[model samples]
Target: MEFAFDEADAAFRRDLVDFLDRELADGWERSEFGLGSAVHTDFSRKFVRTLAGRGWLTPHWPERYGGGGQGAWQHFVLGEEMWKRGEPRGPQYMNVNWVGPSLIKYGTEEQKRTLLPPIARGEVFWCQGFSEPEAGTDLAALRTRAVRDGDGYLLNGQKIWTSYADGADHCFLLARTGTVADGRRGISVFLLPLDTPGVEVRPIDGFVGDHSFNEVFLKDVWVPRSRLLGEENKGWDIVRRTLAYERVGAPRYARAALVLDGLADWSRTRGLLHDPGVQEQFGEARALCEAARLLVYRVIDERAKDKEPSPRANQARAAMVQAERAVGDLALDVMGSEALAEGSRGDAQFRNSLGAGIAAGSYEVQLNLITRLILKLPKE
Candidate 1:
């Protein structure tokens, strides 16, 4: 289906572009740092609050949920402009990509009323706590358990690779509510306040940045029963949807587009595009980016049609994930050691591509999801 934005959408994009241009001026654009930083500067948070005050944060969420009450198309246009300008999307992305929609779908009305406004206003930061020591790739094998108590669930387990856990106000985590025999059926989802007693957060340093990931240790932490998302023993199902929401809806592909545009600009100045080999590689990168764009649009079309879009989501996620890695590899070929520069986010596409394959789910795991869920191929 054709997914171009309407005239109204174009106007919306223009307004957002203008606002961001003003807000992210000299000494201010740094507000758009990624999740894995060791420190999130006050200026960045202030910029997010500014965006929130203007009603642009979580723009895709329902009107009743503190969102701008926009449809998906309005968002696509905004993302395109922001990413093309090499802007920061972390806060807005996390709010719209997974958290807001997840809360709307499964949270209690009280939870919705309590969380949505703060999230949209950028008053609260949320982290994802899903992968564990033994459950990174095999998420169903997670062993963190939440035992039902009188007024809350007692949590005792460790979640590794939690993004922004240190600075976050809360976490959306998956904990076991039953035994191994129950497989994925015994999982429970909860929104746990990071300040709760018995919860300890340890920061992890990653290649490009810190605050990009963390290790969270929960020891008999008490989370009120009201924090449960959806029903008990239903978290695995919730996660399946949440993961899809994260992978498909995030503006990852748009970021890739921005980096590609950078690569083109760099090549023009360096006279690299005139080289036959460089030109050929550049064409390949552009084509891959367009393919990713098409995949993203397909999923968006499915959403507009009110379909679950699970398989299409898988396709888009896998394609975009691979595209990041590929863009880096191509950039390395083009820039070589110069790709190691410390400025401008460290080689732009190359550094991002280097991490893209390993971030979220590995490209291997994403491929597995596409193969099993989308292709429905027979297993050995």
Candidate 2:
């Protein structure tokens, strides 16, 4: 259980730090930018292109796919730095993380040729069509259906709480290709164009922020057979693998730690650092953040070693949510009314905390997984 970074890793981290400092010099804070805001998304488009140009984007991907062919740790380092700065790459992070990797693994040759380059070049935006009005954590219950047509599928369903759907060029969509009773076995993944006929995106304003979520309606939308990712009706395997990557992708602990630093700075500046409660809260949040960082590192370590995925990913994700919520709570407690104002650091942390628990599967779901899979506990 060696935890120290080797020289090469340390050098890479230093270079990444320099790159981020140069790129985000204009007061970039992770919490200040909303996920769906035009300012953030637009900046992300350009910023990720820059990363691609510098060969920083998709570094962990195979070199044949326009990546640097670096290891998983490098990719994790990039994610941490980007997340620490509020993920300047925007939605493109999905491209580099699960989507592109899934495509590389499961896509047909032609599909990979057409899709992988643009993602590697940071030229596209993709939204996930996973959650629905009725099916969230219980994704097997999703009702979105893609009935087989002559040479394609006619998709008719609605996806709710879809992030970046309004601006995304494509959707990593899931639809039932079998009978409803088939449940998880019935699902398939589609690389559907968002602008296909009968597709509609309606914005939903929620606690996170404007443009953070959308309701995507597909009324008899059609997709060609070529767009199907992996084997038809066997997408459950693809989805499970994708979710495994997504569970710990963002390095949320990095952002939480940054928020803790900001809170400490604020406390010191306001002559409140001497307060015993504030110090104690900061210590607790800091400890949680470190715990989360180490837990996520363990998951990454497993990936680097080519080990089988385990419930430890669930543990890491759960720790990250806990750290985020702790920091959010600390921000509100320390800042009080000032934290309530929109766009403030405290407000952003609070919103992030709220969303962290819900996004990428709920905290409760993670606990259930840990109990069943890790603890080997019997269900009542």
- What are the per-residue Cα lDDT tens digits for candidate 1 across 129-193? 88999989898899999998998899999999887677788899899998978979999999998
Q: For candidate 2, write residues 179-264 as lDDT tens digits.
A: 88999999999999998999999988875654678999999999999999988899999998888899998899999898889889
TM for candidate 1 is: 0.92
Superposed model 2: Cα runs more than 4 Å off: 30-32
Candidate 1 wrong stretches, greater than 4 Å: 1-3, 26-35, 38-41, 85-89, 209-211, 344-346
Computed on alpha carbons, the lDDT of every model, listed in order, comes to 0.75, 0.90
Where does candidate 1 have its weakest 10-residue lDDT segment? 27-36
Backbone clash total, candidate 1: 8
